[model samples]
Target: MHIGLISETFWPDINGVSMTLAQWSQGLLDAGDQLDLITPHAHADTVGLEGIPWQDAKPFRHISASRVPLPGYRGVKLGLMLPKAAKRLWRKSPPDVLYIATEGLLGLDALRYGRQNGIPVVGGFHTNFQYYLHHYHLQWLTPLMRAYLRRFHNACTRTLTPTQAKKNQLLRQKYHRIHRVGRGVDLSQFYPRTTQERSLWRQQHGISDDTLLLGYTGRLAAEKNLSQWIESYQILKSQHPSPVKALIVGDGPWRDHVLSALPDALWLGELTGEALAIAYSAMDIFSFPSMTETYGNVVPEALASGTPVIAFDCAAAHELLQPGKNGDCIGVNEAEDYTARLIHLAHDYQQSPQRWRTASAKSIHHLGWPTVNASFRRHLVQAIHEVKRHGRQRSDFVATKS
Candidate 1:
């Protein structure tokens, strides 16, 4: 099968969407399927490309366009592609199915091209861009953004989201042909290490084995809802009998603010590969506070690393977490509950550390990259088959009525 992935973000961008795309591209290529990628140039985020294996994962054909840095974001950028270029590229070597990953101008242009050319276009709901407006003080434009997203996705043959909860939400909002396709974790890279190994790593970093190390790994952004989580951590630290410390990973526009908020934290900025896997293993607990995430890739990644997670009952947590067994999945906006859960988990860990180690290993072992990539491939094939069964005429593509 030949697949076309159109997105504003890709490899080296250091985000959930890009990471997932990279995984899918590599998996598909390994399976003997062809893939064409269209995204912003890696030079847009020069630093991000340093450790990323951009040379290893090669797609069939790659297309890049001009990009401008997004306001308030350091390395993030929005891609700009002309319609003529898109048409010309596809006319020469078109793909069997087109997957639109981002709701930016580049994705929209590719979507339009696919629709006009009778190609099967599948939209991916990866990020909650509409909800992000609240963090940027553009709440007034949220409704407009929401409507635009709905229309854009509805126009596609099928829309794929990472979690069942997100699929349900889109369905309630009248989104057509919504499907649930999950994200996966690389267990080989992110899995449990021995207690002695963890102890040695912690000791080297000046962290005691007895102290509870609460951590957050992802982009430090306003929409991530980091500040509230930091506050909850502070509250947990003060009230809990056990000693607690923080380990902050990743960097973004909110880096300075997070630094100021958690001055005593071990701030290791943007770790990858083995370094990133070790960081997750060192943490006693992983807390994800972002209510705006469509999937929250960190949840499974943390669980895979044998680090118990604490997250709001939304997104991936709504599906993956089993409260008290695997990790605490508190209700959204319940700040007190979030703090209380952290304290409770910390106490439980101190009493029986082995229990959490066992739970973490068993929690998300089913979410390997092979299973996710296969499911995604099936969806793309389904879309292609649908287009073929029905004619390519606009009237024949009644996805909205489906």
Candidate 2:
């Protein structure tokens, strides 16, 4: 099958959407399918993807759309509105299925073109854009955003959500044809390292053996609710006997703000590949307070790296994390409750680190990429078949009437 993916975010973006799409694309190609990616051009000096091998002799084709910096966002770009260009490309060589991964201008154009040409379109709900409006001080636009999202998704044959919880929320909002497809983690790349290797990693980073390292791996932005994580760390540091260290990975516009507030914390800007895996393994606990995530990719990755997590009882945490088993999932928006749990986990880990690490690793052992990719492929084929069946039914009815 020939599939076309349209998104504003793709390779070199270093976010959950890009990462998941990359894995899914590779999986489809490996399973004897062809793909055509349409995405925004990378920013100056940023790395972009090279050629990908396909079942056909021709290399994977990437159509680079023009991009401009997104308003009120740092290090983010919005693809130029290009309905004509998209229409031209699709009309020349139509795809068997079209998957829209974002609701940005680029994705909207592709959705419009595909619908007009009688092509089956599948949408993926990856981000909580409505929740983000409050963070950006555009709360007034919440209703508008929700209405637009509902209309956008209802037009697609099926809208794929990362969690059943998210699908339920969309159903409550009157979204149509919503499907649940969860994310997966790379077990080989994110598993636990040896005790000696972890000790050496800490030594290299100037962390003493006794220090309790609490880590946060994602974009440092206001919408992420990072200040709550900082407050929780402060509370844990005050109560715990062992020295406590905060390790922050990834960079965003709020990096300077976090740095000013917590000057002593270690900030490792955007570690990828093995470096990211090692960082996750070296941490004693992964602290996340964000409530706006559709699915927190870091949560499962942390668990796979043998590090327990402390996250709000929402989104992926609600789906994956079990209280008092692998990690603690506190009440949603309950700051005091979250902080207390953090302190308790810290103290408990100090007593039995090996047991907690083993439980953490065991929790997410089944979230391999192959299972996730297979599910995605099945859904794509199902949508295509449904659309074709409906089309045939409509044609037969018209012929009978004539």
Candidate 3:
């Protein structure tokens, strides 16, 4: 079956959405399906957006990134050239069904064009744009964002999500045709590794054998609540005064802000492949206080790395925690409580790492990407069959009625 994927971003970009797109595209290609991906090609500059060449890896790739123009507050806009982009791919060979990801202009354009052409449309529920508006201090933009997401998703046959938690939340807000597409990780790259990794990381960071290392991995932005981590880190050092080093992996707009605020913390910059593996292995404990994540991909990856994590019991924590054995969860009732628990864990690092190793391995071993990919392939096929069986026009495609 030929499938079309329209996302706002794709690979070589280090974010959760792009990673997931790469995973799903590869998965579909592996399942003996061809994919036509439509997205804003970041590298090119066309009137609206441009296209970049991408090669497929089998049952697994979604190639050829197409771009479009998008406007924003920064004197520039980034987006996909929807109708033109889709037409370009369609001319080669259109897919049996179209899947839209991201709540961006590019995705909406693709969905609109697909419907006009009688192509069955489906969607993936990724970032909650409305929720983000509030976090960005754009309270006035919430209603507009909400309406845009609602109208955009309403046009699809189904909107797939990584967790039932997100699906239920979207449904409560009246999101139509929501479906669950469980997310999994690559166990091979993120599983328990004992010796060489830890030693090398400690050496690189200039830490002695007795030092306790606490780390955070993922984007460092205002939404992540990194300020609290700094405050909490200060409190921990002052109260207990242990030889603890803080390691930050990954970079974002907040890099300067973080460096200015916490001058002593080791900045590993952006890490990938084995470097990412080494960064995770080097850390003794993982702590995150980010409020903006839909599902903190790092939590599962940390657990898979046999590194214990302490996170507020919301979203990702709500989904991944088995409690005490593998990880420690902070109460969602308040933010201070989250900070307090991280303090407690920092005071005693030995027990947390030992217990976390066993639990982390348990959590990641069975969640290989193959499982999630296979399920998605079946879902795409099923949506295609549903359209055919019902003979619904693209514009007439109704989200699965609750």
Can you write out model 3's per-residue Cα lDDT over 40-127, one digit (the tens) per residue? 5544322211221123443223344454334332212346446454576576777788888776766766676667666788888777
**lDDT tens digits, residue span 100-213, model 1:** 998887887777778877899999999898999999999999999998899888889999999888888899999989999999998889998888989999999999988889
- Per-residue lDDT tens digits of candidate 2, residues 149-178? 888888888899999888998999899899
Ranking by TM-score: 1, 2, 3
Model 1 is weakest, by summed lDDT over 10 consecutive residues, at 393-402
**Whole-model lDDT values for every prediction:** 0.83, 0.84, 0.71
In candidate 2, clashing pairs total 0
- The candidate that wins on lDDT is 2
Worst 10-residue lDDT window for candidate 3 reads: 45-54
TM-scores for all candidates? 0.93, 0.93, 0.88
Residue 241 in candidate 3 has what lDDT? 62
Off by over 4 Å in 3: 42-77, 83-85, 393-402
Residue 401, model 3: Cα distance from true site in angstroms: 26
Q: So what's the TM-score on candidate 2?
A: 0.93
